[model samples]
Target: MIMNPIPTQSSEIRVTPIPRMTQGGRWRVEAMRSYTSDLLLWFTRGQGRITVSGRTRGFGAHNAVFIPAGTMHGFEITSQVFGTAAFFPRSLNLAFPQEPLHLRIRDAAPQGDLTLILENLQRELDGDRPKKERAAENYAGLFSVWLDRAKLQYPQNERKSEKADQLVARYSTMIEEQFRSGRTVSEYAQALGITPTHLSRICNKSCGRSASALLADRILYEARRLLRETKLPVQQVAAQLGFTSAAYFSRAFQNHTGKTPSDFRRGA
Candidate 1:
């Protein structure tokens, strides 16, 4: 029997609280992964660490992070940390930053302005007003303006590029592009003119994870997303993700997520 699907909100833009993103201990959010849509994270309270583009930084209250689509990132959120995560679809072609930006807003005036913009954007997306999607897009543009202005105000201090950081950044960019091609960490190291051990060591120093773990985190994140969002069969999903076979994919996925592909697809 065919079951009617549950209703979902508009995909063009979505504003959700930080805690909701991790309601079920969603490891995908905390793992090294990228999204198809640009993400704007506004942290109004508490503090934690967030890694963007292979570099980890501490974040506190009144922080805004803009991650462009296809950039690898992850963050730690504690019970005290509360904020809004806004998702803007890449297809919208809005004026979001081209690179990942982490801005610490110190002044109360700008902080309040950001809060008001987010509230207004959230309202437009949630309401049933005429042309609400268009309205939300406009507000998103304003959000982009706020980002540009804030960037000007809080210019990032230029840090010298250490060898470890450069190597890890290159490795991360490669992983983002070719993770689905079934490339191993060793192969990546070879292409980068380094040994696997050196690569893993650098990755650990840069991102607090080994090279293999980072690669697996990205691949499995895509696997879970495909299983959850698409109607593709297990075998097809495995093939698409460059796994040798469905059984192997099932084992790897279960090892990572503790659930088989089919079971995870059924929301089990």
Candidate 2:
């Protein structure tokens, strides 16, 4: 279920249960997408795999995943997972990590501290109080502090970096920067000084997906978002995303999402 939304004219912060966010469709939650606001997901129960910046890792209880704005990421959640997704607008200018972090909290004290902060944040938003926006901001600031302290308390273990991991990481970064350019996988592989087959091979090994599939997922997620959230015409949307023709955009979108742009927008 959704908690009360707290939003200012210029920014927004909302707390919602993890399972509720995926009530639409699996693709809505599993498809690779980025946001203009930073996202922190706190899982208190269950286990699943999440992919951040081309690296997939298993996550379980008390695992906190922080994704910076504009990072391509996605996660698979099971029915038993219990979590809160706190969205902090990057415009707030709070102290947030520049990179994605996966922190598995092993201690109960810190875990309780995070849960308390989130509870307060949700309460403030749900209550009918004066200056609620300011109170939400204050809680958001406290949440960031909690995150910093938790990071120090539960430092991530370093893993040996394989060549494939490094390569896929670089490719993921490039996709984040240029996904809207409508560049093909071959073109991207060429820019990285590798053949398309080599790039796809490494990507599959790194994330269990092909390079082309990864690129298309990122592109289609943006397309879906724009269609649902904006009033742009179909042709304009296609052009903005660098598609040569509206028909081509329509075909690609349908192939990926099983819905035409207009139909998706109408239903949305």
Candidate 3:
């Protein structure tokens, strides 16, 4: 029998304070298609296959990976799977533990550590303390340690940042770098040597959203990241983002996230 789906909220999706992915023998995960908030994904046990954002990752006795923000990724587990996943952002600018290291273990190795992480996650899941707000902190500690070991197991291979095979690549790159400047679309068009009318037409044809919508999204992404990761006063965040005052920042944040800056920072 099919169970009715649950209701969802507009402000990015977040699951329970802590979610566990565990299953016994012979279970498979179907492809999950949905938009998740900043961070989410934890696998702790068993074995399975995950196809996310076009990359296929295997979750085994000790397989784990993080799906970056706005990355359209998910999994199709071909076997039993278990683990813990967290949806987080850049709030923790980890000092040493997050040095973009590769895991030392091969994909075929036994997943002993994966099991331990799962157990610790279970502990947190059953805890009564306020876990939702502290979730990023916990993941920082875990990721640092795991990434260290994983670094030894897997080394990263950074690809050169080249323009994509599309007309919008150059424009998209510029928008990402200057979205915080709060310039109008015409301003961006001038920098790209394109007219405002052509810019709007191309952007709309390539991206579903309008030029204004995409610019706002880029700005909001950074805003949310800064708000969550740092203890910088809200006023400072506003100034850094070119807002004249905290009040203005609050208004923009509310318009996008539907929560006041202070309220969002308070972990509500």
Candidate 4:
């Protein structure tokens, strides 16, 4: 079931339950959408698979997935799944994971604590108490702390290659800032003081996608978001995304999404 939207004066934090199923009891074909908010998902029951940045992984009960803002992700729950998802606005300023994390809470104590933290966060979101926003932020901070500890106790295998991870993280950050400038992968490589081939290799090892593909993915994600969430004309959207002309943007969009801009906007 879809959880009710949180009513709040500020959009810094939101807590909601994952629906047992999406529309028609099936996952949307375009489920790989990126969000502007960081997402923390705690699965209390059931099993499923999630894809982040083109790398797919399986998840089960007591697993917590942390997806940083602007990362492309999608999930398919094969059975009855129960979970709470907390979305933190980009401006929230918490020291959570900057990279994607798929953590399994194997111990009982941490699992219970996580459940309680989610409960408190939900209560703060659902209540009208004094300083509700502050209380909610506090809960979010606690959640971040818990995540840090959990990572220390259960380090991800990706951390084994620290240098490669750092390079990928830096590349991702640069893409976020310069994706609107129409920079090419070679240009990004130059900025990062690395060759285009080296950059692609690191990105492939980290996320199973090439550097050019990642750049294109970020650009396409922004284009789709603008098309779906705004009333901007196609030409204007193209210009805002640094395309030289509307026709060029249309071609690129069609190549990436298999739909023309007009059709995508209308369907959305």
Top TM-score model: 2
Q: What is the C-alpha lDDT of each candidate?
A: 0.84, 0.85, 0.51, 0.78
lDDT of 4 by residue, 151-217 (tens): 9988786536477767776777777677889888899889889999999998887766798887887
* TM-score, candidate number 4: 0.75
Candidate 3 on 137-223: residue-level lDDT in tens? 564567557655666656555454233213355565566456557678888878877787776676565444455655665566556
Clashes of each: 0, 0, 33, 0
Question: What would the per-residue lDDT of candidate 2 be over residues 1-268, giving only the tens digit for each residue?
Answer: 2221222122588888888877545656688877778888999999989998898899999999999887888899879988999888987899999989899999988899899989999999899999998999999999899889888988888788888788898899899889878898999898989999999999888789999999988888767767766788999989988899999999999987788998888876
| Ten-residue stretch with the least lDDT total in model 4 | 1-10
lDDT of 3 at 223: 65
What lDDT is obtained when candidate 4 is compared to the true structure?
Answer: 0.78
User: Which scores better on lDDT, 1 or 2?
Assistant: 2
Worst 10 residues of 2 by lDDT: 1-10
Task: Point out where model 2 deviates above 4 Å.
Answer: 1-10
TM-score of 3: 0.41
Where does model 3 exceed 4 Å of error?
A: 1-166
**How many residue pairs in model 1 have overlapping backbones?**
0
